[model samples]
Target: MILTTHILSGAALGANIPNPYAVAGLSIVLHFLQDTLPHGDYLNKKSRLREFWKVAVDLAIGLSLVTAIVFYKNWLSDEVFLTNISTGIFFSLFPDFTTFLYRYLNMKFLRPIKDFHEGLHCYENGSRRREFRIENGFWDIFITLASLLFLLFLCAG
Candidate 1:
């Protein structure tokens, strides 16, 4: 499945299908890839990325709620905001929610997936793909290229 978090789907976003549904669908795939990537983040028993992501997510959500209260002046009437959030999460899981479930299951029933993520900033992948499987910026480059193409297509259309 080329569209399965492979980055090329980001390129296809440029095709400009004109149907908001299609664009929305593609965005779902993009977000899934983004969420699945532990690039700027990773998870392990003693995972720094996991810790950071937890704090970041908590802070962001808290800040966003405060901002919403300040901006809207009526948090009680924020049903639309809630709806949009539900939609966002719903759309975000387009490609591989099952994989997430599988990971949970792995940790629940089986053993923790090893070869745990690493901290490889400003360092090379050691002359081998396997060495860098956890920290290869090349994947992000491919994804960026695809996203760029998709944005271009949107502009063209």
Candidate 2:
């Protein structure tokens, strides 16, 4: 799944769930479970600079959207809410962070984490082009919209 989808989904979970620990654990678990769904995998074996730029832009956009939501929902005033949300977002992205460390930084210690992350992907069978297993069109938009709606529902109630 795209970073924006992960961010929004995690934020939605955080916004309503009162238990920070539950939010954190569930966010991480959801990250892998979502990966099992057929979604876009834009990162390819291209130029390192190109991949880095793509990730940076996506992450920037995701975080920016999260920031806007926080302000719009007046979540900043509540420290506990803020912490839970932040934890949700962090854990949700933690797997990808470990992947980056292993792939880009050669952190062999994170090999197991990276393997587990990739093992959950829809096309982990090593057949077909993994990067092109799915296109970045429908699923991204659907998940993003659904998560946004969920967040709005929680906030309104």
Candidate 3:
């Protein structure tokens, strides 16, 4: 899924979960679960440079959207709200960030994580793997918007 969708979904979970530790744990689990679903990703199989630019843009937009939400909701003033939401956002994005490091930095320690992530992906067959595609980009946008709106309603009430 796109980072924006992940962030909004994680933030929604964070807002309702209440417990920081649980929210963090669940956010990580949710990341993998969401990946299994049909969702869009901008990463290209042909060009690493293009993938990097796409990811950079996506992350920048996702972070900006989250920041705007935080300010609009005034969540920073509430310690519990701040902790849960931030933890959720971080943990949800952690898997992908780690995967990037493993791919580029060749981190041996992250091999297990990388393997598990690959296994969780939808296109992971016995010997063949598929690149993530933007065919589902519309779904990503719909889900992100719906999750954000729901979170906003929850916060307001």
Per TM-score, the best of the predicted structures is 2
Per-prediction tally of clashes: 1, 0, 0
Location of the lowest summed lDDT over 10 successive residues in candidate 1: 110-119
- Best model per lDDT: 2
**Root-mean-square deviation of every model:** 10.0, 2.5, 3.1
Model 1, residue 116: displacement in angstroms?
A: 18
Q: List, residue by residue over 1-157, the lDDT tens digit for candidate 2.
A: 7788888888877876889999999999989988887666667434375567777877898888888877877777889888887888888888888887887888999988888888787664333535534443467788888888776655642
Candidate 1, 1-157: lDDT as tens digits: 1122232333234233444455557666555445444333233233333455554553355334334432444434545433433343344333333434344445443222211212222332233332324354455556645544443343332
- Model 1 clash tally, residue pairs: 1
Candidate 3's residue-wise lDDT over 96-123, tens digit each?
Answer: 8888888777687999998898777666
CA shift of 126, model 3, Å: 15
Error of 1 at 33 (Å): 5.2
Candidate 2 off by > 4 Å: 45-47, 124-136
How far in Å is the alpha carbon of 90 misplaced in model 2?
A: 0.7
Q: How do all models score by TM-score?
A: 0.32, 0.86, 0.84
Q: How well does candidate 2 match the true structure in TM-score terms? A: 0.86
